[model samples]
Target: MNKTVFITGASSGIGRAAAQLFLQQGWNVAATMRTPDKEKVLTGANLKLLQLDVTDSNSIEAAIREAIVHFGQIDVLINNAGYGSVGIFEAFTPEQIHRQFDTNVFGLMNVTAQMLPHFRKNKRGTIINVASIGGKVTFPLYSLYHSSKWAVEGFSESLHYELRNLGIKVKIVEPGVIKTDFYSRSQDMINDENLEEYQHYLKTVFNNTQSSGTNGESPEVVAKAIYKAATDGSKKLRYPVGSPANWLLPLRKLLPESWFFAIVRSNVEKGL
Candidate 1:
């Protein structure tokens, strides 16, 4: 029997790419997003476009139930609905901080919680959380974004122990800077007129980040890594995809904390 994969944030980028790739590989795909009606692509006999906002438990539950009704079972769950809120940490308003964590960290937990009962009953499933290289290594102006992803990394690692005993696997995809709308429309900027102290430093770091993004891997590369994680049939917890992630994850592990910070500062912050 063909397996089924339910993906969040399927409107574009890694989620959309994963949906298409899974469908091509003969799996049923539940391509979900906030606005499914606006999605013009990834339609076929095996694909079910769904409206799901991870921040809304009702929407998450409804989408998962509808997907189960349509596909009979969900073999994999991909948590890919998140955005980067970048800027000076002190400039971030309470609302912005809450929104960032609500969508990235808490929202991911909500979806995972909703899927657990179904997955436990089935005795076999996979949860692939799309984190970033920033999850493991921090950058200058992405304090909120990195916090959320770090939370995800820690959550996935600990959750793996509990879920594995139930025959379910939890995986984290740490992608490097992928060439996606995330660098454009999907990113939120923090602004505070009173907090103009860090303007020059912020601009330099932001410019450097944007320039690096132009040379990063495509979303499809991360999609392929996600697919491998889902179907690899092993207990692997972390799969770092893309160039910088693959290279830098090891560097972070091997190097001292201060050294790693220095390297990041030099490459991304200094002379920027």
Candidate 2:
């Protein structure tokens, strides 16, 4: 029997791309999103669309249960349901901070928790967490987003140690700048009109950030990386995708703290 992969945030971007690729590669796909009814892209005999709001435990439980019933077993779980919140850190309200963590960090944890028992029972499974190069490197106007992804990176790395001996693998897929709805539809920009002091700085950094997305690789690139992590059958943990990530990640590690920060400032805070 073919293996099955359950993906969250499958309505678009990397999640949708991965779902399509896995199906084409002869695997069953449980494509999940907050509004499954709005999705018209993914459809086939081996595809099951599920409604899942990662922040909601009931929704997560229901989606997992439905996926298992439909596919019999889930060989891989992709925690791809997340969004980015950007802007001045000082302007971020308590709710925004909580929202960022709730979706990007807590939500991912919740889904993984729901799947652990099932994965444990099977004794063989892969958990792929969709993180970002930002998890390791930082950029302007994305403090909240960076913190959430950093949590994911740390969480996935630590979880891998415990799961390795259990025949369950934990992998983190870190993409650089993928051309996706994350730049627009999936991004939350924190704006405060009263905080005019950082207006020029914010505009400069935001424009620079947007330009990176404009030149970003297609979501398919990250999807291919995700596929490799799922099927490679190795204990490898981090898979950084996209051209920028290839160089950026290593550079961040090699360069000193001040040097790396300077480089980031030069790029994103050029005009400021």
Candidate 3:
């Protein structure tokens, strides 16, 4: 590939899939992960592994420089690093929320800030932000995670408007639940052992996430969407990946607030 792409969280999940896709298409990929050595799957001449933690500013700066040095200049940047911490709102601590935002929201800002000089100098760049349908709507027990995604949505959209006159482009890929380790690795907002206050809601959210996760779409579905949004040269746009997101987003908007929240409450309250 003639273009070089910088992808965060390139070790796993959607980030890994997108990186692999880009590399397979002949693009140079600077894949950074918190534990780059553990990324046994993403190895090749076109790939450069870098150790990066979104929470670490030094790591972000170093990775940006390394990516520019390795690839000449960053044609595209995929902000894909983040984790989900789902649980009842009342059960979440301030620290937990900070950790979530640091990685998902501010971490992304830091990376973008560091890469601006490169993009500005070239006057050409594409930024693809991996947001979620939760960015537009909410689900039970996912307040913190969804909130972060909403921030991503707002930030990316605003940047799209701001940077459009420039040579930069911004797009958001809003995927519905996907079959990723996110569910398995997701932190329990309230641990089952010690968290007894919101037992009912916790059970509801856990059961719902598990049930929905099973039938969710594949990572490739999202990979294809990300590829299009990044390379298509389209202006700021939101591509809702997966049938559920495409269908649900319109429905959620058409429905009244009470109806939507009631439906969410009903579905979540079930099998609790």
Candidate 4:
């Protein structure tokens, strides 16, 4: 029997790419997004679209129930529905902070928690949490986004040990700067009434983000990594995709704290 894969954020970018790739591999795909109908790439009798929003429990629950009803058993899940919260840390109000976590950290867990019963019953499944290189290293003006990804990394790691005996696996995909709508979709909080004082750092960070977003690898690169994690049946904990992401893993470990910070500060903050 062909395995069924459920993916979030299927309307665009990496999630969209993954859906296409899995479909090509002859796997059953449950592609969910805020607007699934907008996806022109998803086709075939095996494709099912679920209207899903990770931050909305009701939406997520409905999607899960639908998946269970249709596919009977979900073999893999790609938690990819999230946007970047970019700006100075001081500029992020409590509401803004909550919004960041609500979508990125808590939202991912919410979906995973809802699906665990399904995974546990079968004693087999893969949860591909879309974390980032930011999870491992800090970047200026991305405190909220990076912190959320860091939480994901930690969450996925601990879950691996907890579920391994159950024959389920949890993996993290630490993608580097992929050429996607990630930057264009960031919620900027630089000059909100609550955080007007952090304009200097915010400007520098925003500029850096714009430049980097344009130069990153295609979203397909990360999607391929996610596909591998979903099907490779490896015991490895994390997979870093893309050059910048793979490079960061060692750099963060080998570089001196002061030196690394200096480089980050100069490249990411000095001009601001």
- Top lDDT prediction, candidate number: 2
State each candidate's clash count.
Answer: 0, 0, 2, 0
Residue-by-residue lDDT tens digits, candidate 4, 155-254: 9999989999998988899999898878776444445545657666577677876787889999889989998998787888889998688777898899
Candidate 4: segments with Cα more than 4 A from true spot = 193-197, 270-272
lDDT of 2 by residue, 1-272 (tens): 98999999999999999999999999999999999999988988999999999999999999999999988999999999899999999998999899999999999999999999999999989999999998999998899999999999999999999999999999999999999999998899887878999999999999998988988999999999999999998889999999689999999999999999998899888877
Better lDDT candidate (2, 3): 2
RMSD of 1: 1.0
The runs of at least 3 residues in candidate 2 whose Cα sits more than 4 Å from the true structure, single-residue gaps closed, are none
TM-score, one value per model: 0.98, 0.98, 0.95, 0.94
lDDT of each: 0.93, 0.94, 0.86, 0.86
Query: What lDDT tens digits, residue by residue, belong to model 3 across residues 6-41?
Result: 999988889999999998888999999999877789
Model 2 worst lDDT window (10 residues): 185-194
> Positional deviation of 123 in candidate 2, in angstroms?
0.6
